[model samples]
Target: MADLSTDIALDDERIVRALEEDIIFGRLAPGARLTEDSLLSRFPVTRHFVRQALVQLEQMGIVVRERNKGATVRSLDPEEVQQIYAVRELVQRQAALLIPLPAPQALVDQLLAIHKEHGEHIESGYLRGVHETNDRFHLTLFGACGNKYLVQTIELYMRYSLPVRANSMADRAALDISHSQHRLMIEMLQGRDNWVLAQLCVDHLQPSKRRYIDLVGH
Candidate 1:
């Protein structure tokens, strides 16, 4: 597996994004070694590209590398996961409240579409798809909050969250329940009740915190 080509050029940013998406989707497991040989074998990229990608993830606390240990996915205990989720809720909730709602309500409609798709994916028992779609739905909403600072902050937490979300998606019940929350959040957003929406966002986040602790507590 070490003879792969590096014909396709991948810049540092694209390389990082590719790895992040793959890792978040569990295509790369925690503690899985990301060797130069393995990456070369899998994709047509240079060591420079691969290192740049991994270095970005390391900075984000998503991956860690060592001389002897190589590069392995970063593992977070439950407390860390809880802290990440708490930050996500705080930043995103405030973002939703602070950002102006743009005209046409297109974003709200899009969120509904995502919820519908997630429900269908769950009903079909495509749990992985459900989690992915749900994540996109929430992130899109959070980004639309129109505050660059909040979006940037919450995105940092999501860097940690993506992997945990994927792991949690393994449980079909949990995936479905998580999808169910999307509607309530959208409803709150639609009502323009920033205050109530803030509280609801916190409430929704607590279950994730508790569940993560229960499943993989520190």
Candidate 2:
């Protein structure tokens, strides 16, 4: 793995995001221990920042802290994965429905820009770029629901969904499909069709959920 500290600033949020990128890219594998000494060396940060990053990751359910063990990336169990996806499906579908029909041109253009960046990152195989852009794409799309609390809930569950989805950003075929879905979603917004868009949102999530469950059975 490349040294993250070289290119990026190491603040608490950036450090946590860096670790999450590492986890998603498979550089930090499931159940990998995130020791203070190890993290301190990886980034040009003090133990204070490292501890803060781990705590933030813990709250996001990407990492867990146990007595005397410090912290390790959380492993997703199949049952829990199913339940999370169930709720995620519901929330995402509802969010889709709530988006104002005839999405403003400004919002559509913003989504288009983000999706374009996602394509560029996927083509270059920049895993972290792809990850961050993907998050922005989804967050921007769902945030259009115009309910801050709903957006917050969706974002929270999206973070919790990360454990199972960690390595998915690396799959080229998966990225292709995902990007295509993003295009379809953009079209849905253009057409101002809520029901079809809602269904598409639900369908879009199934591939990753199914792929994860198949790889890691309950």
lDDT of each: 0.73, 0.88
Which runs of model 2 end up more than 4 angstroms from their true locations? 1-11
Worst 10 residues of 1 by lDDT: 1-10
lDDT value, residue 171 of candidate 2: 85
Mind giving the per-residue lDDT tens digits that candidate 1 earns over 37-63? 887776676787787777888987789
Model 2 lDDT tens row, 1-218: 86766433448878988888788888888789999998888888778888888888999889999999889988887899999999899999999999998899999999999999999999999988888898899999999999888889889998899977665777899999999999999999988689999999899888889888988884
| Cα RMSD for predicted model 2 | 4.6
Q: Candidate 1, clashing residue pairs?
A: none
Model 1 residue runs over 4 Å out of place are 1-22, 25-27, 99-104, 124-132
Candidate 1 TM-score, true structure as reference = 0.76
